[model samples]
Target: MKLLRWTPLALALLAGAGTASAQDKPDPNLARNLAATCAGCHGTGGRTVPGSAVEPLAGADSAVLMQKLRDFRSGARPATIMHQISKGYTEAQLELIAAYFAARK
Candidate 1:
C-alpha cells in the first residue's frame, strides 16, 4: 500500500529529471544560431542580396574574416556601424560566425 502511494511521487521525480537533463545539453546548432544575427546585413548564409553593395561573407577566407572582425572590434577599421556591432561579440563567437559564413557556398 505504501509503495503504491509513493509510485506517483517517484514517477514525477523521474519526469523532472528527464527535463533537467535535456536542458543541460548544449544546443547543437550553436554556431548557426550565433551567426543568424548577422543576417540583417550579411544576408542569409552570408550571401548579400544582388547589387546591395554590402560585402558578401559567403565563401570568404576564414582568416580574412577573423582579421576584419578583429579590426572592426578594435576600431582599426572604420565603419558606419560595424565597429559598434563587432564590439558586442567575444572573439570565440566571432570565430564561429566567420567559420559558418566561410562554409556557405
Candidate 2:
C-alpha cells in the first residue's frame, strides 16, 4: 500500500528532474544556427574556396577571431557588412561562433 502511494510521487519527481535537466542544457543546435548567418559570405562551416577574396574562417585562431568579432561589435573594426552583422549577436553568442569556426578545420 505504501509503495503504491509513493509511486506517483516518485514518477512526478523523476519527470520534474528530466524537465530541469533539459532546461539546464544548452540547445545543441544553437551554435550552428547562430553561425549559419556567417555562411552566406564566410562559406559553409567557414571553409572558403582557395584564392577567395574573403579570408577562410576555418581553423582561424580563436583568440584572433574573438578579438576581431569583438572589434566589429564595438566598431573598432571597419567593415562593409560585418559591422552590422556582428552587432546582431550578443557577446556570448559571438564566443560560441568563434569557437565553432575555430574548430571547423
Per-candidate clashes, comma-separated: 0, 0
TM-score for all models, in order of appearance: 0.75, 0.75
lDDT tens string, model 2, 50-102?
78888888899888999998898888998898899888889899999999988
Per-residue error at 93 for model 2, in Å? 0.2
Q: Deviation in angstroms for 49 in model 1?
A: 1.0
Q: Considering only N, C-alpha and C atoms within 3 Å, which residue pairs clash in candidate 2?
A: none
lDDT of each: 0.92, 0.91
Q: Which residue pairs collide, candidate 1?
A: none
Relative to the true structure, candidate 2 reaches a TM of 0.75
Q: Per-residue lDDT tens digits of candidate 1, residues 1-105?
A: 999999999999999999999999977798899989989998998999999989999999999999999999998998989999899998988988899998999
Residue 37 in model 2: lDDT: 85
RMSD of each: 4.2, 5.0
